[model samples]
Target: MICFNIIQLFVILKLCSGMRYIDLKSNFISDGVEVQHGYFMTSGKYKMFHARDPALEVIQFGETRVFPDVDYTPGTHSLFVEQFKVGDEEALSIYVFRMSVTSNSVVYKVYFHMSEFGYKLIDCAKFTELIKGKIHVSLDLSKSKSHPFFNIHTKEEHGQSTTLIEIRKSIAGFRLRNVEAKRYEFGRIMDSSFPIYMGYSKLNMFLTKATSIFIHKEDNRKYIVLRHWTKNIRFDLMTVNGILAWNAITDPEPSLLEDMHQKVFRLRDRIDGYRALNPLSTLDLAENISPELLGIEKVTGRHGGSTYALYHLEIGKEAYNKIKFVVNSEMLDMLIAKIDDRTLYAKVEVITNSQRTFLIITCLMKIDLVYETVINYYDKPNMENTSYYHVPEPYQTKIVSDMYKKYPVLINMDIDNPPSIVDHGELQYDSYILKYFRIKQEDGRGSVLSGKYAFGDIWQKDLHEIGNIPYEGNKRRLKVIAHSVNSSRIIVKPKNMEYPLLPEELQDYVIIDG
Candidate 1:
């Protein structure tokens, strides 16, 4: 009995390692990890100090200020620790630490806040006096609907503020892939390697580590969004021994996955007035429609010249025409730039005001690649089918019968052997891609596996306009990002000299570090 208890404790300790500090950061939402902003730096707790361990002269501060250091340690793990010990008397430290990172470039946006007792201070006033108000400041700003900054805090920035972001070549980060107060407020995506390499063998290897596995179905393609709660999934790790014992504890087949996947994506409660848009009248809510941009032409009227964007949406044997009015040629240039080779399309809303009826580009429904690291993915299934659980897809739209095949459909296209974006447009670019990857050293560079595509080292980040004002394109939240930040400070840092098949249509992974 004694030996058994000791063994159990040992097992628990081993499992408890590698836990995350999830409670540190608030909701840092980014259209489902589609885009990432500049580095989030917090100097102080910015909250009510619950505990003050007198043993430590000062509290912890970093990306997650006052958050508990990982490993049950006391100090936060910033990318770099800045300090100045005046003399033999004592040490005064000022630091900026990044969130926890494993063996990969992706850093988890998580931190914990436990009482600090790591290092006791000899002179408390000296340390506290220099950095009291520096860490904590009153955020006078209101959480107004009109305010742009997601992080509403009032911590005063120090002189060395830019040193943290600028000193480093680049940094890759992820907030919780979540939605709050909106239609869906799920947890953060701990990892997207499952969706990144689902059909491949990657999902089988890393499924057990996922605390909650969700199947996100947009159109025909279903994406696996894996969420692992920090410290919660301790005992449920997928070690080598765990994998060996998987057969005894889990299902023997992929039936659960198949069943869950086959289940169609259903709509929950309608958030906006979209459902009540009166389908019988001039405006019909486009439930499940993919309209391709036919053409854009500039028309000169008696007053001035106006550009118009034409779209052809096929809805069950009938073609719904949509003409979008543009303000100027610059708008047309931006639209054409995004829709260069690939068919640029949007899900639109038709509106009429008794005089003229037109289409308001509602959204560009797009699924972009989010790069993540995975130990491996295999064919093992846990006992519970996670799909059957969670928020149910509430409302179901009536059948449109495949839009009665308006556009040409290539039925026999091979999804298994999808096109490889080695280089740009033509076949000659293959050599260029080969040259580029060889120079980058395919396996050595720590890029994501090339199973999905030839060179898979890319991520999709939503790049909105810099300030509070959102990206007001022809289509709202346009599915596009400039290669560089381009008059903005929100570019993703170097990705293992990273690569991401971005701008979905082009499959162009811009060169930053390499």
Candidate 2:
């Protein structure tokens, strides 16, 4: 009976190893740096502290102040930490420390408060002293809508920097990815490592250890995949779920993959069938759609622009979802010029027939590739104008009917004439309209198409303004601007990197009084 109790006690101790700590004072040392008056816990408690770095003696002169309870529940894996006040001034004078713990590491995101006292001490070197390393800051002030963001990097390895905290508009978000302690040439000790590779869906998650499973989210769709990589070899394949049990297999069976893929196809069929039975006006469907259904198998080739990369995925026979990834290289160059590390603009799009497209995301891909935050193109109205007009003759009607046969019809206008929708002056037509364009490329100063085109043999080549009535002093000017057959989204590489793709009000004239 004593031995049995002892065994049970040992099991309890093992289970209770992960304990929570708060309000504990410890002038403890970690990685050879002194941490004072902060919380402490067991070996694997993922230590998070909320005390003023006593080493920050320059600004520590004030009345002793306590902080709110650190509301962190280990079971739920919550990411909530309170701030500690230093000065007896306003709330802005307090130091907000948001610490995040993953499977392998603990990250401290220290923000020098937004108060008058805190704002004055925004010095890069001084802030580093408050922490425990020689840190570098990257300030991105490119977007006018959003304020500058500071990326604090730990300069640990000789001539190498690893990001620790990202301070955006006063909130500090910590990321501990591949951090290793080392001494720099100037005797400054800090954390450094290779740039972390975080996928689209993984933005909501933080992993300290190298992850074999990754979740990718695009266009309101979520997909799970298994990926493994070494110095020279890499393997990536889609999976149903991010289950560790399935990942434990040394090698997945071909039959297992085939069965899983067939099941995914069946799921897509069920979703398509449901949509057909109950059609909706909004593109945001009611049914939950998995990204695994419309998965991007591979990247085909490069599009016209230097920054744009094209990827292909098979939706169905004769139907495709051509995806385009736009990376602003010019802006990246400017960022490189300004700071050692620059923020990159990475956007993804899904293009189908007849300008039926979706803007998946317009986000900032960090230079380290550790994080990506979606850019909300401020609250603007859905500026889209759609109209329907009938074709006069059998020839034109036949041409329109062929395109209509390829896709579902929408009788929105209540007109005998099938309507054509125009977004920002660009005419949207079906895949059958592909015969109306001719693909070409630029040769010298005057060029036809920067990319591929498809033209009908019946029409004569002429320059014409496609959109609306322009205000010409006394005359109307008809000029060919650009054309794309495969992609509905316009691709324009601006010489000035600061130019934004703001929505322009269409100068369209629609006759309502028929």
Candidate 3:
């Protein structure tokens, strides 16, 4: 309780005085990397210790401490007091400096300091001066070759850069590039769905190809505003120009910084809200969340729309075992959902927000190896045995010819014959279609017979017709090659086969070869 009181007192004092300093005992991590305790020189005294981390383009400090005898006065330090730290863990503080590549050289200045409730910008002397007899890292300016230059004004004849100055700028450029590359690398490793363009710019008039940074002064304090745009979202960070300070997102916005700030804060709040829920398990987390919480809405269809979220959930013990989920608003009118236990189960809905269909769902099971199988209920059988398409008369013969070519036993008897046109008794042509038929024998084997009498027609028809009609000559039978036992359906070959007449029967049967 005493420690808490002391901390509270310190915070009140710091706020009242507006003196920024770091508390060195707090936990500190920077850019996903842990930072060690360190000190900065102030007024020729190494009295301040700090923990620093790199965030975006600047280094933010926390856990700051000051030695005894240092006057803890607010608004007293010079803007260019060499350097200092304003890190406080419990204060949610951030303080930093920034570097930018100008046309002639790299410029350095104190950036901004920010806390949970407020932010401040410092205005100080900007410098490009190099330390004497020192060498710095070289900038690979070639990386910006593919980048275009825009609205750049360079004094070609006024002066040439000294080799020392060029070297210094190159070193600064390398540092900036390293930071950018590290950021991209982190994004790639995490497979971040949102593209992060750190210092991204199409035009590279400067070595850094930095996006435009705007400076504004309000209430005698200067602010440096930085802008970045992904395809779907925009972001901006505002910091003090000369002091190690920055305004919180809650700070009063200048009109130019309004929209992007709103968007970013909205998203940040959403994420923070979910994290605050602190589910004990994955299922609990999934069950507790809704689409709206992630900025997703009931979309019309499955086409193009902005995605609200994309994230992965771990389901197994393996280091790489995880499932990805993506939520998006679609342009389509139907709401569609598919579920695979391994990762997702999406529900699709119609434009009216009505349930349309439940797609197939697969469940992933872990055994010796992870495997997936469709649930039985979701796997419906194809309950159809009818022709899939109607063939045109002209194409029917060609189709039969192709089928016969593939299977020689499948004879094309009417390959060249077209049905003769009836001049009389057009209604009699319909009589040939039997209304119903049934097999008399219990062991109904091959095809059924449809002829009137095999007894009388045995001598009139050729041997092929008689042989084709099984059980011929005595009781006489005509094979019903294809029968609709439930309904009287007839299938007369190559001719009728092309456009087969429906069987007039009452039973359902499909011929299958043994």
Name the best candidate (by lDDT).
2
**In model 3, what lDDT does residue 482 have?**
29
Q: In model 2, which runs have C-alpha deviations exceeding 4 angstroms?
A: 1-203, 206-311, 314-514
List, residue by residue over 121-194, the lDDT tens digit for candidate 1: 33434444432322211111111221011232222243211110001112243322212101111111223221
Q: Judged by lDDT against the true structure, how good is candidate 2?
A: 0.25
Quote the positional error of residue 75 for candidate 3 in Å: 62
Local accuracy of candidate 2 as per-residue lDDT tens digits, 93-159: 1233333343312233223333543333344344333334212121111111211122333434544
* Model 1, global lDDT: 0.23
Q: lDDT score of model 3?
A: 0.24
* Cα error of candidate 2 at position 487, Å: 18
TM-score of predicted model 3? 0.19
Where is model 1 poorest over a 10-residue stretch in terms of lDDT?
160-169
The digit string of per-residue lDDT tens for model 3 on 1-514 reads 3455655666566545544333333422122221111121211111111222221121223323322123433322211112223334111112222422322232343323334543344332211111111111111212221111112222323333111111111232434223221111000010011211112111111111123333343444433333322111122223321112233332323433334344444433443444422211111112122322222222111111111111222112223222222211111111112234453222221111122211221233443464433221111122332111223456555643542343211111110221111011111124343222122221121212222101100011132222121111112223323211122121222224232333444234222111
lDDT of 3 at 76: 23
User: Which 10-residue window in model 3 sums to the lowest lDDT?
Assistant: 183-192
